[model samples]
Target: MPEAKETVLEIDLGALAHNYRYLRAKIDDGVKFLSVVKAFAYGNDSVIIARKLEELGTDYFAVAYVEEGIHLRKNGITKPILVLHPQFTHFEDIIEHCLEPNLYSEKILRSFVETAEAKNQKNYPVHIKLNTGLNRLGFDHPEIGTVKEIISSTSSLKIASVFSHLAASEDWKERDFTVGQIDLFRKMTWELIADLDYEPILHICNTSGVINYPKSAFSMVRSGIGLYGYGNDKNIDPELRPISTLKTIISQIRSLDKGDTVGYNRAFKVEKPTRIATLPLGHADGINRIYGKGKAGVFINGQYAPIAGNVCMDIIMVDVTNISCEEGDEVIVFGGPQHPVKFAEAGGTISYELITGIQRRVSRLVIPE
Candidate 1:
């Protein structure tokens, strides 16, 4: 590895493949695997991660926007890319890039069809998103009739797939809700298929949905965080490897007396003699201030050093008194076997927030296979 930088996110493609294979094992051999590479592949460099997954034989790729799909297309990604939340304004670009848009509303559906027609395109692939339980996006069950009517009337558009999002696939207590979602998804898609002359692929399983409801894997399953080495369930997490590690080096070390304070607002006061190590990472680097006040810790020389004081925009101080570390010693915020879930849990959040919140400014080092 090159000399330690101020801070870096080390991405291990090998671990990513491991997670993909593990998730693949849960489904039947014929079920297609769709890797969600949106949000920069959950902030792990979508282009790099997508390339690897492409080589690994992913059946499809998904992103949150049309531009994200365009980015992949620009970088030579030819596999079918799904724009999960496409905007009407980008329908032309979506067609230009050969990216499938997830049509969830009447306006978007009509707009995309008109745009495709104006562009002289025919039978452009599109996915329909149903509002099963996550009211955030997708059309309601009643609107399915309107959706079918619009698609049936359009020669410019074709339904490539039908899917929905699960609101709580990870929580066993919400098993009933998930089951309801699965049932509704199946019913809605089946009805839509029966109404149409041709059948499109159907899917609704996200990462957690894939693990907890494998039987609901209809035609294809989308794995987002799970492919990045998190199952959203503790029992299954051990089988996956975290693909990204946020590491930084200590910039300086300070000794504080019993009365001395650290960081802005003196959020942390030295109750006893303490040693603090300042690192070149802070909220600006995706370490939220909520992780301050000893809520989060970083791994240094095999020992966990708790955060001491408020997190600044460009720096943070850690209580490294008991750790055997020096200036420039590498400190791991989260990654590999340590897992970001622990950090998220300690900070009153989830792993998704930690990983996706990582700023694009942070350097990402991709590990060779």
Candidate 2:
């Protein structure tokens, strides 16, 4: 809310809107977009993301848990929400909140049907997740008979959508396997309800699938990171601005001698007399200590500055000696033009991890255009 502050996470709603609109424009008319809002919209506040997506006319919202769906429903979100990993124990709460469940295995399928029938809920919307090589969750294609059994026996649960997840849509080396997976899904769905009249919406595309192979963009595309701004494949368009920005200020300025050592285990031994800045942010706020040890850089007065020494739980050291920076100077921890932080290269992890790993400790400040 304040103009400038220490240790803040800035979210650009405009960038979010742009990404949503861009991805939406890419898909065909009949193909709907179900933006994933799980993990607090990848640690950027789900309520805000869900509301924004709804305003952007997103087809649906997907989360990994029932609690997440409840959060959106409580926040006045009446859009179709799919819980990818709905627990059997919370079946009652899910029904109470009118949140749909993705029944993956036989046990979950039977459990959901029984619960819905007992509650006298007819045509209760549900999704059937098939394990199309992901092997994480979802019933295997061979188990289509079980889905048929559930459908034939129960009138309570309705198969609103039958979907699968792509394990490696981004890797071209896995293209053969991805193609096989897609084929398997088609064969399984067709054979599962050959005689039965099952007209559930068919979808099996994640962000990468939506971008690379729009052919599989079936009924809906469940996108998470793309809507958050960084589509793992950066080649999409530079105009898709990263919605999140990490910022902090210099807590202290220490003038180090040429041979001065800094931080735990004396990790940073200065080669030059440097003016190092101690930032008011560190591992505790999701800037992992590994991010230190000369791995990343930050922006100081629109110039680049290298991080010095090991990052601590509450403080990070930046070598701002070349920038003519003074005490209490504003520090931009990447996400900007001068020294943009490449999440993959800097974190040695994927953009998904970098964005989702942002701890709850950091306060999110949303700025809508």
Best by lDDT: 1
Q: Which candidate is the best by TM-score?
A: 1
For residues 1-369, what per-residue lDDT tens digits would candidate 2 score against the true structure? 343466888888998999988888778998888999999999788998889889889888999999999999999998999999998899999999999999989998888888999999999999988888999998886788878877888789778898999999878899999998889888887776576675788888887788887887878888887887765565764746778887788888989898889999899999988888898887878778767877887888888888888989888888888888777777778576532337447857666766777777888888976
The residue ranges of model 1 lying beyond 4 angstroms of the native Cα positions read 1-3
Estimate every model's Cα lDDT from 0 to 1. Answer: 0.90, 0.83
Q: Tell me the lDDT of candidate 2.
A: 0.83
Backbone clashes, candidate 2:
0
Q: Specify the poorest-scoring 10-residue window by lDDT in model 1.
A: 1-10
Worst 10 residues of 2 by lDDT: 336-345
